[model samples]
Target: MRFSNYFIPTIKEVPNDAIVKSHILMIRAGMIRQLTAGVYSYLPLGFRVFNKIINIVREEMNSIGGVEFQLPGLSPNELWMESGRYEIYGDDIFKLKNREMVLAPTHEEIFTTIAKANLNSYKSLPQIWYQIHTKFRNEARPRAGVLRTREFTMKDAYSFDKDWEGLDVSYEKHAHAYRNIFFRCGLKFFSVKAHSGAMGGKDSEEFMVEAEAGEDSVLLTEDRTYASNIEVAVSYREPVGRKNSNLSFEKFSTPNIKSIDELADFLKITDKSRLAKSRVFVNVKTNEDGTKTNEYILALVCGDDEVNESKLTVLFGLGLRPAHNEELPEITGADAGSIGPIGIKNPNVKIIADQTLKEADELVSGANENDFHIRNIDLTRDVNNIEYYDIRTAKDGETIPGTDKKLREAKAIEIGHIFKLGLHFSQKLGAYFLDKDGKENPIVMGSYGIGVQRLAASYIEQNNDENGIIWEGEISPFHIHLICVNPKIESTKIFSDKLYDELGKKGYEILYDDREDIRPGFKFKDADLIGLPVQVIVGEKNLNEGKIEFKLRRTGERFLIPENELIVLLNNYKYLFGFK
Candidate 1:
């Protein structure tokens, strides 16, 4: 690709709205342009890199017998309804104007429906179908460039099997394929146990890349053998010895003390372990017949800890949202700041407590009045009809379960996710097949996805400097950045043109800077911003000396090689600098 003919609109200044480095650099590099909030149009330069990532993904998926299909981006709303995900996805899913169509955020329901129409026997039991297509989501607040986009390309694959054992084998193939895809893309990533989220499944794992701008929080052991998303992470906590405080439950007048921090300060209490924090949630439960009922749940946890909503969801088997401040007065007859287990007069409301408070006694709690708190409240005796579970969010210093090593928290971007979906979609969509025993069963399925553009942004997040993005070897837009300094000069132009032609004939993708108008300094800056793995520069001075400058973008190592040794050195470096 010649720079003079290419459409790389490199900007001299970064966009003001761009907060993260990847977002700033991507726009400045002329790779992507935001059309609207959370939406972007990829320029030629960016699309090339994006295409390379897609190709890498395709190669890996194909290796695992994944048959690619070009599914429609716009899917019928009825398909989503059949899988019972239409309402579950809620505001995140993009719907068409007719209300009968939806942009595909995922293809599980569609693929399952396809399988139901086609496969009828166990002979076709194990089938892996995949597609590289655009997915749409109406992100409430999309930021971080392509990392969280409203519309982006996704490589989604689905596996169909006759039984759980077959599903396990299919899942392993995809898991191995995902590892290869990320590895070949030159990303530093780790897989961790993860919740399926809205994508209902029995088990799932996320491929995460550590980055400062990441949104997901991952907990890992020191050696990294055990890791999980914070929503379902488990940690060891030293048992708190039950203090022998024989104080009875008593409510007292405490003016303007609602929060635990305020109560602790007002009562001059130093130990926070003796305090219980109450939280209210509005849970939506779906019955077996597809009816949803709204209920109020009062959750209690240690004052120092916050509730892990995902754990609560798993416990109640329902979708939950934080109760609105306006709804609190009607549900619990108290404001959010002062609601407590003892103050709740409603006996029908479900109350769930954290396991940390099982034997806890003499704890401070809300008095249910406008401005009062109850001290010396025994959790076991006073809090009635309370179910205890492990719903506390994991923290940094907590020890790993059954291990002395402490858990470490990291901010990471989720690049890929693989889920053992079980019968979540297959059963709902009636995708069943007969086994060898001639018994009809729901085809066990698994869903695997890789965010193609997110992977590119994550690559930039992990490998970049002040200059711009440092494109990885395996998935770089181009392998070599060929620069011709003072291209107006016949000697410089001749040397660069000859080398670029020869390199291309040698099967190297080169971004040749043959533009005569741009200054050498400007070209060098563009080279650094684009960040090809290797740069070969031809200047008039070097040409006269029978030498050309070769620079490695990653190491900033410059080498002056004899003109005759150009092809030999480049051929050797190409192999030596290949991605692991």
Candidate 2:
């Protein structure tokens, strides 16, 4: 790829809207151009890198018997309806109208729909299908360049099996494949326990790159062993060390005490051990015809803690929202401000508590009436129908759950996710196969994904320095950058042309900077900004001495080598940099 004919538009100045290092460097290096908010067009330089990443993913996926196919970007709305996700996915999924056609944010429904039509017996028990295709999502606030694009490329793979054991095998195969893909791409990533989110799965894991510019929050243990997405990570704390004070429970009139903050201030208690907070929610249950079936929920947490909705949903197996005024009295038998677990016996409604509240003996709580409060309440004695678990949001400096390590925080970008979907998709989509006993059983499924473009951006985000991107050698846009410091000089031109021809014959994908009018500083600056792994500098002084300058992009190490030894030196450095 000769610079004179290539679209390598390197810029010296960073764009104003580019906030992160990758975003700035990408624009300056002419890798990509934003077409709209959360949408981008990859230019020649960018496409080269993008193709390399996709190829790596394809090779890894293929090695594990993943059959590739192209699913349609536009899908029938009826397919989603059959899976019951048409209504649940909401606006995050891009809906279109070729009268009734919809754009797919993911291909789970269509993939299952195809599998059900083709796979009918237990003999074809396990299959892994994948595609490297474009996915569309109507992101409301897409920012950070390609990191959060509305239209992006994804490598999504789906696994199908007739039984639980086969599904486990398929899941493990993909999990191992995903780790290899990221490792080969030279990404520093960790696989953390993740929420299934709207995908509706029993278990999930995300491959995340640790960076300050990342949007996701991951909790890290003191020993760097246990890590998880905040939604799923458990927190461990010593139970409150207080004996049952034997203080009698009493109710007192407390006007205008609606909030926990206000109640605690009015009670004149500095310690949160004595306070309990009640939160009410209305769980909307959808009927078969997509109608509403509203159920009420009353959640309790320690006064000092906040409810983690992700944890709450996992505990109850239902989505949640704040309670409505009309249903509050019917459910909790009290108004919003004065609802508690004490003496309220509603078997229809479920109650849950933070585990920390169990050990605290004498506590204050709502009195089940407006403008009234109860004090010296023993939860075990006063509340009959209650369940206990760790459902509270972890605060800073708190000990992480299931480990002796204290929690440390770092921002991270989610590059890939592997989910053990179980029967969520199979059951909903009715993708079943006939077993040996002639009974129909829903297929157990798993999903694995890699954000094709986001990984490129994340790589730049973590690896770039002051000059520009230091792309990992295995995935860099070009393996060798052949720069001509004085293309107009006969000696420099001869040396560069000979090397370019020789390297091309040797199968090196070289980016030859052959522009005659460009200055040495401009070429050097552009080389740094473009960030190829190996730079072969052909200059007048070096050529006059029958030598050339070789530099490594990542280390900024340069050395003079004889022209005769350039090929051997380049090959040795390529091997050292983990490139063939």
Candidate 3:
């Protein structure tokens, strides 16, 4: 590729609206242009990188017996309705054609539909089907460039098996394949347990890359052995010690004692052990008759902690949100700030508390009346109908479960996910196969995904410096950037042309700078912006010396090699960048 003729636009300043590093660098380097919010057009350079990533994914998937097909992005609404996801998915799905058709956010339903029509009997026990196609979702707020696009490309794979054991094997196969794909792409990622969320599965895992600008929060142990998306990660601590049993339960007249901080200050207690904070929630469920019921959930956490809704949902097997104003009176039987679990008579209400709170013998709580509070309250004596569990985020110095390491936290982006669906889709969609005993059984299913474009953005997020993107070698747009410091000089031109041809023959893709008017500094800046793995500088001075300067994009290491030895130098570094 000749740089002069290519549409490689490089900008000096970052865009004002770009908050993430990848978003800014992508726009500044001219790799992509925004067509609208959450929609973009990948220019020539960006497309090249995207294609390379896709090919890598293809090779890895094919190695594991994956059969590729092209599935339609536009799916009929009847198929979704048959799968029972149309109502559950709500507005996130893009419905079209006067609410008759829909754009698929994923292909599980479509794939299952096709499988049911064609596949029957035990002979088709295990099958891996996949597609690299466009998916659409009506994201309420799509930001950060391609990271959270409303319409983007996805590599979604579905596995069909006859039973649970077969499903496990198929899920493991994809997990192994995904690891190989990300490893070859040179991404520093971790596989964390994930919530199925709207996907609806019994088990799921997400591959994440740590980044400050990432939307997801990941909790990690100090030793990095146990890590999970904050939604599902569990933290450990010694059970809160029980106080003396003789402490009396008494009511205290405390005014405007609504928050934990306020209660702590009013009590003049340095330790949070003396306080219990209660949070009100509403459990929303849709019955078969299409009626909605709001069940009030009062969750109690330690004064120093916050509720993790993901853990709550997983424990209860239902979706929950903070209580709304209209539902509070009927559910909690009091105002929001003055509600308590003590002496509550509502049958439609449930109370749950963290294990740490149950161990407290005496503490402070809401009085279930306005402008009043309870002090020296004993859980065993004052609170009734309570369930105990770990339902809050771990503090900084808290211990990690099953390990001695202290807990730590960071923000991260999820690039890939693997899940053991276990008949969630097959049962709903009636995708079944006959067993060896001639019995009809639902096909066990597993789904795995890798966000190809998001990986590109994550690369920039973790590896960029002050200059621009520092692409990892395996996934960089090009293998080598050939720069002609003075393209007008006959010797410089001849050296660059020969080098480019030599590298090309040696199986290295080269981006040759053939423009005559651009200055050396401009060429260097553009080279850094595009972030090719290796740079071969052919200037008039170097050509006269019978040598070329080889600079590595990642390490900033530069060395001089004789012009005749360029091919050998590039060949040696090829494997280092995952080219084998």
Candidate 4:
């Protein structure tokens, strides 16, 4: 590709709205242009890198016995309704006006529809189907360039199996393929156990790339043994030594105790663990008649811990929002900062307490009245309708549930996720396979996905410096960037063309900068900005000396070498030099 003919509009200055390193570099490199919020247009330079990543994902999927298909992104509402996800997805899904259809954010529903029509026997027990397609979602807040786009390319794969054991094998196969795919794409990443949100399943894992600009929180141990997304991560807290006072709940006047620290100071308790917080949440559902009804829940947790709504959603349902301030007064008979599960006015409200409060006693809680609190409250005697579960977010210093070590926190981007969606879609979609005994059973399913554009962006997040992106082999737009220093010089132009042809004959993809209008320094800046793996420069001085300049983008290591020696180096380390 000749730079004069190619549209590599490199920007020297960074955009103001861009916050992350990847976002800033992508625009500066002229790889992508924002068409609108949550949407982007990949330029020629960017499209090559995007396609390279896609090819790696495809190869890895094919290695794991995956059969590719082109599934339609525009899916009927009946398909999502049959799988019971139409209402669950809510406003995040892109729905057509009065068309009873949606632009698919994932292909599970339509893929299940395909499976139900074919592959109906145990003989087709384990099959893997996949597609590299565009997906759409109405992201409420789209930022970080390609990181959180509403429309992006996704490599989504689904596995079908006859039994739970077969599903395990299929899940492991995908795990292996994902590791290879990420490694080949020149990303440094790790896998963590994750919560199955929206895509409900028994076991879920996410491939994470640690970045300061990442949105997801990962709770892990120092040794990396217990790694998980914080949403479903479990923690251990040392038991607070206190016996039940066995006293009846006594109401006390505590003025302006809005926070747990204030409550602790008023009660003369050193630790805030003895204080409990009462929070009310409501999940609204669309009834059969098209009316919405609220399901009220009282969530109880230690003052030190916050609620992990992702975990809470498993026990309850989705679409949980904070109850309105007026509604809270009617349900709990108290305003905000003064409510508890004991003696609640609403009988239909469900109460869920964190497991840390299971053996709690002599605790201080709200009195369910204005400016009043209750003392000497025992969990067993004070709250009869409470169910204890781990609905609290994992604290940083808290020990692992089964170990004595504390948990460590990391901010990371989710690059890929694989879920063991056993019978979740198949049973709902009526995709049953006949066994040898002639009995029908739902096919166990697993869903795996990786965002192609996000992967390209994440690569820059981890592999870039102040200069620009330090693109690596197997995913850089081109294998070599050939720059002609003062291409207006006949000798420089002749030498640059000779080297470009030489590399091309060697099967290397080269981006040759043969423009006489651009200065040598400007061409070099664009070369570094684009971050092709290797760069070759043919200048008049180097041509006079019978040597050309070679530079490695990753290390910024430059060397002067003759044409014969450069060819020798290319042949000796072709793959290491990012040759195709």
Number of the top lDDT candidate: 4
The TM-scores, one per candidate, come to 0.96, 0.92, 0.96, 0.94
Over 4 Å off in model 3, which ranges? 97-99, 286-292, 345-347
Worst 10 residues of 1 by lDDT: 571-580
lDDT (tens digit, per residue) of candidate 2 on 220-314: 77566877888877777666545767888899988989878888889887766557888877778778997987766667787887878788787
Model 3: per-residue lDDT, tens digit, 157-228?
A: 999988778888888898889989888888888888888876557678899998987898888775678887
> Each model's C-alpha lDDT?
0.86, 0.83, 0.82, 0.87
Q: Please, what are the lDDT tens digits per residue for candidate 1 over residues 1-580?
A: 9999999999989898899989989999999999998999999988998898899899999999999999888888888888878888889999999668999898988888789999899998799999998999999999888899999999999999988888889889999999988988888889999977765677798999989999999998878888889989988665443677788888888787778888788878777766788888888878899898888799888888889999988776657888888887777766766777886756677888788788677887776666767788777777777888898898988988777987899999999999998887877889888888999989899999999989999999888898887875778899899999988999889878888898889888999999978899999999999998888999998789999999988888999989889778877676434533
Model 4 lDDT at residue 34: 94
115: Cα error in model 2, Å: 0.9
Q: Candidate 2: where are CA atoms >4 Å away?
A: 250-270, 287-291, 324-349, 366-373, 400-403
Count of residue pairs whose backbone atoms collide, per candidate: 0, 0, 0, 0
- Candidate 4, 388: how far from true, in Å? 2.5
lDDT of 4 by residue, 374-456 (tens): 88888887677778898889878778867797788899999999999988899898999999999999989999999999999
lDDT of 1: 0.86
Better of 2 and 3 by TM-score: 3
Q: Which scores higher on lDDT, 2 or 4?
A: 4
